[model samples]
Every structure is written in structure tokens, then in C-alpha cells.
Target: TVIDGVTNTTTTVTAGTNPNAIAVNPVTNKVYVANLNSNDVTVIDGTTNATTTVTAGTLPYAIAVNPVTNKVYVANFGSNNVTVIDGATNTTTTVAAGTSPVAIAVNPVTNKVYVANQISNNVTVIDGVTNTPTIVTVGTSPYAIAVNPVTNKVYVANQLSYNVTVIDVASNTTTTVTTGKRHNAIAVHPVTNKVYVTNQNSTNVTVIDGVTNTPTIVTTGKSPYAIAVNPVTNKVYVANYFSDNVTTVIDGVTNTTTTVTAGTNPNAIAVNPVTNKVYVANSGSDNVTVISPSIDTALPLTTAVTSSSLVNVAGISNATVSSAPAFTFTATSTYAPTAPAIRTVYYQVDSASGPWIQASGAGPFTATLPAQSKGDHVLYAFAVDGLEGGATAGSSGEGSGNSPMVGSVAAFAFSVIDPLAQIITFGANPGPVNYSPSGTFTVSATGGASGNAVSFTSTTTGVCTISGTTVTMVTAGTCTIAANQAGNTDFTAAAQVTQSITINPILPCTPGNFSATGNAPCTPAPAGSFVPTAGATAAIACAIGSYQPNSGSISCTLASVGFFVPLTASTSQTPCPLGSTTLITGASACLNLPLLNIDNSDPATVYDANTDAVLLTRYLLGYRNADLIANARGTGANLRDAAQIETHLSTYIPTNQALSPFDVDGDGVVLPMTDGLMILRRLLNPNALNVMTAAEQSAITANAKRGSLTDAQVLQRIEALKP
Candidate 1:
């Protein structure tokens, strides 16, 4: 049955048996139907209702058409491949696919085909350019597939897994989103990127947000299997197999559902966005059901001005005319017409008198008129059927035989105005002035009518800023300030006037009383000196050893201890040399002291020899030579002073008048003056040693034997003989 939407009339045509899937080429006005039992595709000529058969692979289960390319694809479940038919040549080509490919979809923009392999549980993406196949793994038992051309995302319905797999066409990566159980079919709204999946077992439709991948379940009729979406209206159509009805889900801010009686066993669905209609293929009934949306009469045909502000009119209503010169008009028709139609807009100035001038030929039509004078203007727009040639009421040639059948007229009234003119001038030109610490100045504009506002701008923002009539200086530089006025509808734009301003550098802050203003004050303190405050009565003196080198310094630095500065307010200090020491506080110069070196040769001068000799003489006054020699030998090298010699000689003297250190000839016998006189004689004469026995003399000779025996060695030998 072919239904004429305008007349609500129907016509029937026979097709092959068991038509499971259907697709249409809106551009070619042809429809392709996949006949499962016949294993062929029936191409129906939409205009003449003529049918042609093209053989396909075994068990053709699904069909999709790329209207842009005029190619139709059929998925074959039994043969495991897809059949592609070029609508122009009507020739068939078989492309290999995965096992049991049952569902097929195509993205017209990208010219790519996606086929869901039921048994293989994967999707095969075919490049429309090369006709090559790339297999992408998805969820288990993939049954249906859909693609959104705008986002280039393909959605595959996996029946066993109860989820939908979203595939990124460029990367072939898949993301699985859980949905209702037994998802059998899927559809996508290209504009919104929202996916609709029909769950067969759950009897519901799952709406999934492509960006978030979150699913919202909407309950539908029993056994909902086939789904389709209208991208323009964002409406989803679901075909229920068991319920024998089609559910319309309005995918808007609030999702709502409405069911309409469909042919028996509805299996496949498709939507026509331009016509705002849905087509459902019913296998059991062997017919297709066409459902039209309810008409919105509020705005049957909307008119708009597409061009500039010359005509600020839109939506077939009264508007204000701007001061611009030209504009274009466009229209949107809500009702789908059966035949070809043409939109015409007529316009008139100030009145509805005389014949209306045809200003536009078609919708989204453009016409540039000469600039109109400041006055009232009116416009009216209407659409006419090309075939019937009948016009609507209030349109040209109304009720005439040659006029369009159905038409609507929307009248618009507006007013225009003439361009404005203006002139602006500054009150007085600002001259060179001294730099101010506040960075402020005043300026005023004189020209242009009263109440005309003037704005100010500067050529150099770094030098100054002009807000209204005041110019604030930033730094020492020159800048030109401009005053301008933008005209209104009655006045033209004003020419800008400029004024140049020069700002000089400001003088430094003055110092008070004893403080100097120059960089350097004291001789040692150069630029930075201790001055406490900006304008001080007197400069603060540096500490005893500290000084400041630069002027305007807040504090002084301490002088290092190793170096000293004698003068006050000194910048630097002198360092002390290596071998000198200075006072810790403040020393002008370091002091140098004399040093002495000692010789270790003369031991007798350092020791008390005379005291030792007196103590020995008292202790051995009447002692015999043997006893004195014993006492002298006993007092060895310990006889450093007279007191020690006396203590040792008297404490150790024997009862028989025996004394130590009295051995005259080193024969281990006591002898006092004999040993001393002998030693002195030996020191005076070289060969006189006959006062002792032969053994003692031989011993003395052995002990005194040395290569270089001088007077010191003789004294050492005499002391050894006495001790």
C-alpha cells in the first residue's frame, strides 16, 4: 500500500515472500526490501510503484542503503557475507564477512558499512572506498549495528551479553555498556549522538548517551526488536514483534512513549526525517506500515530574515527595520507536502494598496532592495504547490484555476530610519606640563549636539589612560588623547579630535637640616649613607667600626674584626698583616714585638756549680781521700745545686768516716781531695796521673780515652771521677 500523505490515500503493491528488512534511497526515490525466504532483494520504484528483483546471498536478513552513494547492502546470515548492489548499474557484488552476518548499517557521510556477525560475536567494518573488511571484536552474539556519521561511532547490539558495544570508527576500539537483556536491534540519532537499543526479552528500549555511555530504559510493547531514530526530531521508533505494534519514543528533555498499531510481527523499522514519518516492516503480515507524526499547527511555516540588520524580521511576524541597506529571507515548513512546492514573499511600503511586489521566489530566498527612506513598510509570504497551482486565501490569484492548492500568508510590518551624522571637537588642547605624583589630568570635549556622549582613548596606554574626560598619567612619556562620539539614528558618526600631552620627570624628595641631598654626603660614605628617614634633620652616625658606602641608606654595615677603620664614617677598613695583633675593639695599627733565640750548649752557666762545690767542701772537709772519692762518686749527676749535694753527702756518710764521691782515680774507692787535686792536675798538665794505684790508673786511662778531649770533656771526666 502506498500512502499519499497529503490526501491520506493508500495503494497496495505485492512483493516477494518474507521481507524481513527494508531500506530506502531518498535521493533516488527507490526502496530496497530484503526477502528472507526468497533470498533476493526487491527494489521498488517509489514513483511508479514498479518492482525489480536482485539475487543476493543465502538468507538475506538485513538491508541498508547509502543514499549519497546510491548503494544498497544486504546482510546474509546463511552465506556469511554481504551483498552490495550499485543502484545505478543494478549490478551485484559479494563482500566476505564474519560468520552469520545478520544486521547491517551504513554511515552516509563516511560511506562505511558495518555488519554484525551473530555467531562470531563481532562486527565487520567494510571500507566503502576499497570494499575491504576489518573485523572488530565486540560482545557475545552481536545481532544488530548502527552508526552515527557525525560522531563516527558504531553501536552493536549484543544479544547474549545483554549490552551494546560502542566502536570508535577511526581507532576500532570498543566500549561495552550494559543494557536490558537480549538487545536485538540498535539505532543512533546522528545529531544528538544518542543510541537506541531494543531489548527483545526485556520488552524495552534502552537509550544510551554516546558521551557518557549510560543507559536509560524505557518500557515498550512485548518483544521489542527493531529500532530506528529520526536525527532531526530526535524521535526513536521501536518495532515490537509479538505485540504487533510500533512504539514511538520521543527522545527529548522528557522521554515519552506512544504506541501505534502496526502490521503483524513488526521486525524492522526506518525513519524519514524530512517527511517526519516512520516505516516498519512486518514479516507475519507481509506488509510495511507507515506512521506519520502529529502535525504542530502552531508554526506550520516559519519565516526568518537571514541577511543583515537591514530587515530585523523573523518568523513571519512584524519587526523593526534597521538602518542597514539590504537583507535575505528564509522559511521552514512543518507540514510535509506531497508534491513540489514554491514559496513566494510579497512586500509593500506604507500601505496594502496596489499590486504586491514579488520579493522572494523560494524559501530561504534572497532579494536585495534599494535602501528605503525612513518610513513604514509591510511584507507578506506564502507557499504554493507547483502541480496543483492553487493559492491560499489572501494570496495572489486566490480561488483561480491556475493558483496553487494550499498556501499560507504571513504579514510583517516594520519601520526604517535615515543614517545619522555628527561632528566632535575637543574644548582645549592639553600642553606640556610637569609630571604629577598622582598621575592625573582633566580634558573636555566641546563639539557635537547637547547630551552627546564622548569617549576618550589614548595612542600610548603606557604613558596615560583617559577615562571619560580625565587623563591619568602613568609614566614620563608623550601621548595623544582622542575624543569620539558614535552617532544615533538621527545623527551621523562624529570625527575624532586629538590632543597631545607631554609629562616631565618629577624632582627627588628634599632632605632636612644636617642631611645632604646629593648621592654622596661624607667622604667615605659614598652614595648610600645612614639617614633614618626620607627627610631627616641629621644623618645618623655609623657605629665605632661600621660604615655605609651609598647615600640614602637606612642602616650601616658592621666592620669586619680582622680589618680596622680609624676614621669615622669610613666606607672601608685596612687589614692587619700576618705577624701582627690588634685590639678587638678598634685599632689603628698592629704592634710588632722583639723575639730571642737560645743556645743549648752551655749547661754549667744554667746550673749552680759554685753552690754545689761549697756544699761538697763542707760535707768532705776532713774526710780521707778514699771516703771523699766514695762520696763524690755517690753524688753523680744529681749534684745540680749546693743544698742538694750537701743533703746527699751528709745523709749517706758512714760511721767509720766514709764519704761518697771521693774517688780520686775512678777505681771504685773513696778519695776526696786526692781525686779532686788529681783531676785538676790532669786538666792543667797533659801527662800527670801517678797518684793512684796501677789498676786505678789503667781504669782512669780507659774511661778518659776519647779522640777529641777538650777542657769541657776534661771537666765531665773529673766530675765522673768525683761521683
Candidate 2:
């Protein structure tokens, strides 16, 4: 239930079953009500009166909101956990707590949540950033919780243990405080650094000294269930459940009490410190009682600018706003309200019966009037109590309200001058501009109110000049560019924006662009792009068949053989896939693998098997000279020793290739101990190679499989390579 303070009106919104606890985020104007039976929370939008239901843990008994993080925490008694609700997204994250988490409070300044666990006799301290929980042991059956954000302390009221536990959030250490019996509620006066605990089972309230942590009893009406304090007035209101319609109001400074009449069973209480109004929720009477100090019927005072009224025709003594006529005015003679409520000043143009609109918040307020048409304009300025559309306070943001006017309306009969409406801004900050290459760059101007084309003019006499939208540098000095747009019949001429573009006299090579080999200009393009322009350069992507991996390249490098360039501006090469080949230098794609002639023996291309295998054995055993040609079948067997054999093997396996026929085991590497041995065995005795014994395979040493395939994989590849 929400109430209007000014009209004494009540608005009730629906929530889930057994709504037991309520919390509000004043910054977002969102109200959160925890429903114990429904195991959910109902979020009410203060502006629209709409409701959104969010699921919480079982039996959400207590709730608190941290306005800074826009998060709400609900202490679930049945689930032994707390459900945190994101106010912006309405999402929930359940954080584990101690047993029977009954009550919760938040220190918004520290972004920490404190939940009092009744069964576990501890308090769960939840860090808002990580939503992580840390348990701090407290008195037995800790029930109610309160936080002192200013001092970073948490106070818990223990029902069964009959004491208050103050936890210093910085240290996570506890200070036991002796207080009244069966503490049901606790409140902290941050400015005073004092703590107050209400004993529901007794006729007194416990006051704990802030510095000493010592408890003092302040007598109150019987059975106080809930309590509230007004930091502004230093007055505390205690809701005595069984006090028979009497609420004890204690002066915080004097520690004295005054009994005020209220509805039966004043169980919940709140205070509007700014208004000095106390509101009590009397559960037994089914009504809320509003308590306020006496207010005298003194009309609010107001005044407007002193001026010789302009005639609307051609006659004018001065501008409505004077002395070069700027738009600004303090809402003078508008303050020092006799009533205690916060006040706002409102204004209406040309109409007295129309809705009053607030121009500023709390004074000293200033109002910026909008551009008005030509006419004798009378601006009605007055003040009202509270926020601008707020029944108690006027609405805040140029808000609309029809509340009764507080003071004398000030009327200024002034001609409405279509203000210099055009506001022009440079597309970029013209702080410093370079002068090289074409000695020119395009300038842009926007935000012309009359939709007129903006023109540029060079303000500097000789250093620089402008033609159309382009600014050409004449020399190295300050180049001031002024942009302007002529107003139409409706608007006045726009104020031009003059920007001085500095071109240094002694130009040192700027960062990013370095000097060439002998102190000349060097504008290097970024990697994968080249051919940079003089000013604000954006080089195009490297052409196909070429790449520029480093900055400031004169040209892109052509792709070499064994690699292909498929994409534009490719900084790296791509290898052909398995069983594919490309012989063309600077090729963009790979072709199907050619039918390889492995012989290279006496018959050149013909593999009769025996002679070709023997020649390869000679090449493998590091044989050189005539030994490489001994019994070789082909005169084309130029391969001998390591480098020549490596070159021959590379022809079949392109750069970065993963697989090749020469790598018989296809383990992506050719090792003498494994691949070479297997190849020789296959050529010498193809029939017995598949059944090689484990002892023989042990010769495939560690380096053979270091970053390649395993021995089992090598064996599988050997099987696949078999005839």
C-alpha cells in the first residue's frame, strides 16, 4: 500500500501471499515486497504503479535493497539462503546463508548485505560485487538486523539470547552488546553514531552508546514491535504493538519520550525527515496515521525580474534577459518558506489557468526558457511546496502540476525573441591539424537549427585558408577556421564557432609516423595495408597474390611457391591441403596432387621396385658421390646427402603442409628412427614390415614422437601405407 502525503490518499497494489517484508530502492523508485508463503517478491514501479513478480528462495521473511548496486536481497527462512534480485534486469542469483535466515539489512555505501539467521545463530555477510557469503557468529536466534553505512557496522537483534551483536564490517569481528529482553528491532542514527534496539517483550527500548557499546534503557509504551528514526529531527518513533494506540516518540538528543495518539496496534512506522512527518501503520485498525508538527497558514513569497515591459511591436528598451542577454536567472524572493516542506518554483508561459510547470528543483534555482515566437509573452512564475507534480513536493524535472499556487505570481511582459537558436559544433576537435601531402583536409560542421548549409571561412590572415568544405594549409602556424550558417525568416543568425587549428612552425615528425632514412617524411601504413596518404590516411587492403605484413611498406610482397594467397590483404600464407599441389608462384589456389614418379632410378620414371628402393637406401644412409649412384637406375638421381634429399622431399610436401607421401607414417614429421626405418623396412621387405616385433619397434626413440604422433599412431599410418 502506497499513500499520497498531500491528499491523504491511499493506493493498494497486489502482491503474492503472506507479504511479510518490504524494502525500497529510492534511487530507482522501486518497491520490493517479500512474500513468505509464495516464496517470491513483488516489485512495484513507483511511477507507473505496475508490478513484476520475481521468484525467490522459500519463505522470504526479510528483505533489503542496496540502491547503489540496484540489487535486492531476500532472506529466506525455509531455504536457508538469500535470493538477490537485480533491479535493472529482474534476474535473480541465490546466495547460500546460515539456517533460517530471518532478517536482512544492507550497507549501500559498502555494498554489503547482512542477514540474521535465527536457527544458525549467525549473520551471513554477502559481498555485493561477487555475491559471495561469509558467516559471522552472533547471539543465539538472531532475528532483526540494521546497518550503519557511515561507520561500516552491522547490528543484529537476538531474540532468544536477549542481546545486540555489533559487527565491524571492516574487521569481521563481533562486539557483544547487552540490551533489553527479546530484541525485535534495531535502528542506527548515523550522525549521532548511536544504536537503538526495541524490546518487543518488554516495556523499554535499549540505547547502546555508539563509542562505548554500553546499553541504557529508555522507557517506552508496552510491547514495541518496530521502530524508526528521523535523522533530521533527531526524533525516534517506536511502534508499540500492545501499547493501546499510543506511540512513544523519543527525542534523540535529550533521550526523552512523548506519547502520541495513533490507530490501534501501531506495528510499523516510518518517517519523512525532510517533511518532519511521522507515518504509523496500525495493523489492528486497518489504517495509517499521519503525524506532523503544526504548520501556520502563511502564503509563500515570490518575485520576478524588474524590467520595462517590451511592447511586442518594434519598441524595445532592453532584452528580456539583459546585459548581452544570457539565459539564466536565480529564482529570487522565492525561498525561506514558513512551512517546513521542501519547496520548488514553477513557471507558465502566457497562461494562468493552465498546468504549472516547474523550471528548477530546490532553490537557489535557475530557469532556462525555451525559444519563443514573436509576441508579447507574459511568464507566470510562482513557488509551490514539495517536488513539482508531487502532491507533497512538486515534480523535479521540468515537471507538470496543478497544485495550489503558494505566492504572488510575477508577470513579465516581454517580447519573445527567437533566440540565437542555431548551435554549431565541429565534427572533430580542430586542436591540431597536419600540413603535408595535399596540404588539405575536409572539415565538417553540424547542428544548424534552421537546416541551412554551413559555410567555412579562414579566420587566420595568411597561415591557412579555406575553399568550400576543404581547409588548405598555406604555412605552419595557427589556422583558425570559422563555420557559420545564415538563419531563415523564423530564426536569427547563428553564432559561428571559430576553431584554431595549430600547425607547428618547426614541425618534428609526429608519433606514429617516423622520419625516413635521412630525416624525410615517412607515413607508414598499418600491417596488411599499404600506400598511406599524407593526412588521416586509411590504406586499402593488400591486393590478391600479395601481402604487407609490416607497416609503411612501399608495396605488397608477392606470395612465393609452396604457399598460396587466397584472401585480400593476407599477411600470412596458407598451405595446400593433403594430396594437393601448386607449382605456380604467387598462386591463389592449390590443384590436385600429381601422380608422383618415385623411381628416379636407371629407368628414370619407371619403378621396377628393386633398383629404385636401393637408390633411396643409399640416399637415406648418408651415402655421397659415386656411392649415391651405385646401381642407381636413373641418371636423374641428383639427390645425395641430407640437404639434397631434404630439397627433394620438400617438392612433394609444401610449406606448412600437414601430410605427405614421403612421411610414410603420416605423423607430420620424417624421423630416421621411426619414419626412415619404417620406409627402409617397407622397401626391403614389404611383407614382413607390418608384423615388426615390439622389441624392434623400441628403436623408434623418444625424439621421433616428441611433438608428433604416438607410436601406436605411427603403426596405424604404417598399416595405411602398406601395399
Predicted candidate 2 versus true structure: per-residue lDDT over 109-169, tens digit per residue: 6788898989999998889999989989999889889988768888999998899989987
lDDT of 2: 0.69
- Candidate 2 segments exceeding 4 Å error: 295-723
Q: Report lDDT (Cα) of residue 72, candidate 1.
A: 91
The 10-residue segment of model 2 with minimum total lDDT is 321-330
Candidate 1 C-alpha lDDT tens digits along 497-520: 788888766443344213243221
Scored by TM-score, the top model is 2
Candidate 1 versus truth, CA RMSD in Å, comes to 27.6
Error of 1 at 142 (Å): 1.0
Query: What RMSD, rounded to one decimal, does every model reach?
Result: 27.6, 24.0
Off by over 4 Å in 1: 243-245, 259-265, 279-290, 297-301, 304-723
